[model samples]
Target: MTTIKDVAKKAGVSVATVSRFLNDSGYVSLEAAKAVTSAVEELKYESNPVARSLNTKKSNLVGLILPDITNPFFPELARAVEDVGLTYGYTVVLCNSDEDPEKEKNYIETLKKKYIAGFIVTSNQLDAPHYANAKVPIVALDRTINEKIPIVSSNNAGAIMGTNALLERGCRNILFLRGPEKLNPANDRYEGFLEAIRNSDAHYQVVTCPFHFADSQKIVENVLKDHPQIDGIFASSDVSAAGALKAAGIVGKHVPDELQIVGFDGVAMGEMLSPGLTTVAQDVYKMGAIAARVLIKRIENKEIEQNFYEVPVKLVIRGTTREGME
Candidate 1:
């Protein structure tokens, strides 16, 4: 393999000049930089990241920890994180904690030892002591973490608008399909749902389940049997909403007539369902981008105006909820 020495020799410049040009550190004359660039291209010299990291005291690596890789929501979020990290010239390392607190802590500890520049976490646990005590900058994605670290999330309060839309469509009683109550986002969504129907004549019920499509489907199926009067549903996630849709079919309930449903996350798969899912659409991609941007700034010792950022959300009307119902 061609080394920096070969490039320096070919460019007729000192090794120090070549190093400066390669790392973009300190300063090298424009002429010297051009010569080094040309020589590097000709020699196809690849910089040794290990050596460079040793000198700079940091690596161009960032860690992204998510609760479950099986969830569709996380995959989309992870894709956005990777794309944004690449644009900033950083490589992202993904870790799936599987909702295990011990696994999450272990991954954080391992990544820190590898000199990862920063972290973006969507933790399943309520407490994040590992992240709190981390040496590098850390940012929360989707879920809020400790107060010291920054958080990027969707507008939880805006979920009320989606619930209200269901009520406007003549749904008398609504069911809120949510995740664990301990999760910050789930709790916020539950609060928003209650606030939307507080003064309305319609009644509401809550059903907590794991964030798996199959598990949610089973819970929803049983709920429909137990409470046949439920006329509408507001699922905290698109996956759960999809499951609700399936349960409705299994129970022989006519969608948009006997029952209406709306979901969150605005995932593209929502449109592919037989009756497209109406939802409170949060920009998951934008959330990931903002998290990466904020974490990068912190890693570079740049000042950010705010530690908490909420990406906007909007209600999307679709076939699942009655159209033109006011």
Candidate 2:
């Protein structure tokens, strides 16, 4: 409830100086900054963000726009991004686009009008020039937007190594259950699957799903019924992998003997599932951290490089793809 005027009186400085110091702009000399800090402690003056936003045209917030918040992968990434943003003294505003380009456009405009400090855009939609004039720094996550915008994502091409690991274990006839090409992650992973299949003598093909759990389940159930010869699967997500496993059971097929599965995104469900799905774990934590750091750097004018960052990926071979498999 203490006012800036009160702090100024105690510190023997003008209220404008206190306001500028609190907003992290309008540099103050070392001695004056020290006095302002001391006075802030003595009076406990809390600056109201609402008033500051009106004056400085900023909300002191970083917008985190994701394609699907319901997906375990994105929420995990969001948590990491929030943590990183907190470290840099910014609050994160979460928005779910649900893979809708229109909704994403609206959210971008809304956040732009709100004057968020920056943006961490993680979308499944293609980049649009509508946001080219968007103020503040924007760092894309998990996919590229435009050549002008920077993207930080996992080494999607490296999934071939994981798929090859499964093939090396004597599993041929691998099935790739992926989402639509509209999603860049799915496209990159599908290309990686192709690379692995082409390099090995193993046979593989892809099946497209709607990228939702219910649709993936229903579609995979039909696929399993038709192709009873499938021995292994590389799913674009943990959800699809789970769907595949559930369908295999309903069809009375035991996993790894009749069917082996490897999922993407080491979501909690991956480890908790029966047979514990083998998956390639995207370094989501590092992705989030790097996105946050880079966005902040650009905001502070310290970011020298404008390029794509490909984070590392690791194959988590679990109970699903065990030793002694066919």
Once fitted onto the true fold, the runs of candidate 2 whose alpha carbons sit more than 4 angstroms away are 304-306, 324-326
- lDDT tens digits, residues 22-132, model 1? 776778998998999899989888888988887666788999988776777777788888998899889999898877889988988888778889999898566768877
Candidate 2 lDDT over 175-269, as tens digits, reads: 88977877888889888988888888887778997656677777778888898888888888878888888888888878877788888888888
> TM-score for all predictions?
0.87, 0.89
Error of 1 at 223 (Å): 2.5
**Model 2 RMSD in angstroms:** 2.5
At residue 44, candidate 2 shows an lDDT of: 73
Candidate 2 lDDT = 0.81
Clashing pairs in 2: none
Report, for every candidate in turn, its global Cα lDDT versus the true structure.
Answer: 0.87, 0.81
> Model 1: residues >4 Å from true position, as ranges?
1-46
Residue 203 of model 1 has an lDDT of: 85
- Write down the worst ten-residue block by lDDT for model 2: 124-133
Residue 44, model 1, lDDT? 86
CA shift of 123, model 2, Å: 1.2
